[model samples]
Target: MSDIAIWLVRDDALPLGQRLTAALGATLYQPWQTPGDSPREQFRRCFHQHRQWVLVMASGIAVRYLDGLPASKYSDPAVVVLDEAARFAIPLLSGHEGGANALAYQVARLTGATPAVTTATEALKPLTLGIGCRRGKPLHDIERAVLSALGTRGLAEVREVATIDLKADEAGLLAFCERHALPLRVISREDVAARGWTGQPSDWVQQNVGVAGVCEPCALIASPRGQLIVPKTAFDGVTVAIVEDRPQTAVRHEP
Candidate 1:
């Protein structure tokens, strides 16, 4: 089940609105339903009930309603503005903040429409990795882990790690390592799960066998997803992480 929903406003006779909805649903590969021919008040009431939905509005009238409604935590949804013709897809209000940018792309892919994705991070070819700490996740979780890992022999000389380096790309990591004079060795099973993550090493482990010669256990490993776990003993120092995706679903976990 998706925590997202789509709202389509259209003329009763035209199939453009419904077709666009179908296209977006097909591309997302997730179940999404449209509230057909409903009044604006009813739509607002529906949105108020569910907060995580991504509303795809296909009309100027709906957009007007969206503009007039004051921002409220319980009422405003991540709105995606689609022209009636679906000729162009525009992600206005909640672009990056509300997952609107991703929703826009899905709309484009489904309807062969162009998405007006203006976020610099998405526009730039960058890797986006998000490290998550379960148990009432706090920023301190990542901060403490990085601070703890910094003192390890391999990372002692490193200082000021970029939070964004964890983006879903390698260049970010490489750049962070280069900027800090320290080695950001990949956390291997030996380093991440000396006590557990056992079994024959995978191809990735074999390739990075000795990339840094500094084999120390990673204090913590984080991914975009919110999965996390601490392995017993020391590990190979190379750990795989997860990155952010369309729905902002960060599934960080221990392997």
Candidate 2:
């Protein structure tokens, strides 16, 4: 078995992600296709076969199955979804917090397909993960390290502008914050787009803030004018309509 495992739906033709799997040495588990298995029962069989690490599911079937499980049961395996063509790579389930994000980039680089990333912190550049997740939560050493890594010269300003539909396994970010005692500012999408970012952003979150969790303590909201920096990721997956951004209540302060 490979370091990462994928539960896939079997099909004809060279599936889009087969090359990626071969390259990554991912163990492909096709429980549904096993003989004597009932199509109706595939959900159960697939569920029983699930393990930790990264999982690349084929259709909404897996999404519904996993979502039905309680949130605590989410051991937070990095999850990515690939359409039948494999032309598009979508990190729907555990994108950033779970490590699905980096995995998506890997798949995108290998397949030459566009990664459909939709996190806020990643859209902007030089974001601070320590400040995004736990707003009031203090991050001590981790804050200092992030400031040093990003080389933020001026004072730090935070705002929670808007919220995106965020679902991540924030272990790395949470660790950084706890060590440093960093405080996050919450804002709105309209706020991010209304006002340009002031402080430095982290490299990871800069890739795609709204699609990527780079801005942890903040979400990246975009508009015709520019972008807004929200405090948290989006809630309620149904409404991509996004929220509005008001002036940042927090100013340049600790972290």
By lDDT, the best candidate is 2
Which portions of model 1 show Cα errors greater than 4 Å?
11-38, 50-59, 68-76, 119-255
Model 2, TM vs. native? 0.43
Structural similarity to truth (TM-score) of each candidate = 0.37, 0.43
RMSD of 1: 15.6
lDDT of 1 by residue, 128-169 (tens): 222212223333334344444433323332211222112213
lDDT of 2 by residue, 33-145 (tens): 57786543654444434333233445465567566642532455566666556556676656656656557655654554345556554333223232343333233433443
